[model samples]
Target: MDQIIELFRHLINPAWIIDNGGLYLLIAIIFAETGLFVGFFLPGDSLLFLAGFYGNELSASFHDAPFVVLMLLIAVAGVLGNMVGFWFGRKSGPMLYNRKDTFFFKKKHLHQAHDFYEKYGGGAIFFARFLPIIRTFAPIVAGIVGMDRKKFMFFNLIGSFAWVFSMMLAGYFLGKKFPGLKDHLELIVIGLVVVTTFPVLFKLLFGKAKGPIKTEAAKATEESESK
Candidate 1:
């Protein structure tokens, strides 16, 4: 477990991101993670936070990197990613269910995301942005259900702004203040991931059936009218 966590520690390191592909790569990953099914394994929250945490270093190295502007662009990337994912779901949702679950992928995640959309409708698109894997699947589920594109885009725009800016900005500022947190990043990342995922988990395990409910009073009224 320790080894695994340690490995992940490096995976989301801001310096690694900068040294690797910098702004473009970051945006691409953010898009791919949310838009592409194959991107399910990428650590999004940690990466965004890391960008904020290491904003100074990143700017210094990149020389002319616009910190806030980059974040906004990242937000755009996230929104666009979901939009693409929505289209993918519309086109390929059938094949998706056919593929079996693996260590890297789980049909359960899609089902859970589907439930979120069913229960909350357009709102789930906004909500799912905060959750990791669910964020990836949320837009897709919206597509599968054939949600209006306008509604999806509206919710997607709002959710993307909320998710990307809020998270990345928080990371950037928090990182500036608590610079030491990065040393214990595995713990921080785990805690963040757990806290965010808890709501999804709670809803899935304990949530009541939200499928169409016929009220007893309505049923009685209909029967009386029929009689």
Candidate 2:
């Protein structure tokens, strides 16, 4: 936990990256987080927030690049990562379903992705990008289900840009308004997680209540027609 937090601090610290190192690291992290299934555990949202928070510091220290440029680069990295993930999922689509005993590819993950895809449809591609566990599995599920390539790309791009921009901008603005915010960054991060996860919780608890009646009514109509 300590190491992770420190790493997060370092990545966002403008002083840590004088030149190419910062850019490369940021891009690599973005790609891994979105493209690799195992990378779901990474601190994507928090990292973006921190990046925004430190944007000013970086801008002052680095003359060759502005903070906006860095943010744009990060945003582009996130978008490309999703595209790569989608393609990877598509490429491994068949093996993901058929393989049973692989270390990296678990059946349960695939099933969960399937359920999310079923429950939310294409919207899941966008919405899932906010949630932790779900976000990681969404692209893989999209690929496995043979979701339309153009449609997935459209939603994926929109979701990635939205998420990256919001978090980064929030960090930057908040840091500017309240310099002390850096002290309580963890709390802010928690708040973000809560806000993002609430929708998924709402859907799970109430989605059924909204549909069972209509389902039963349809079933009754079909039975009456048969009789």
Best candidate, lDDT: 1
- Name the regions of candidate 1 deviating beyond 4 angstroms: 1-7, 201-227
Misplaced by over 4 Å in model 2 are 1-20, 60-64, 97-106, 190-227
Q: Which ten residues in a row have the lowest lDDT in candidate 1?
A: 209-218
Clashes of each: 1, 0
Candidate 1 positional error at 36, Å:
1.2
> How does each model score on TM-score?
0.80, 0.73
The superposed Cα distance between candidate 2 and the true structure at residue 219, in angstroms, equals 24
| lDDT tens digits, residue span 1-227, model 2 | 68866775665444564343655666678777776777765667776777788777656554658777877777788777777777777777656555664544555555555677778889888887777656777887677556788999888888888888888898899899998988776688778667766765665555443211112334577899999
Clashing pairs in 2: none
- Residue 183, model 2, lDDT: 77
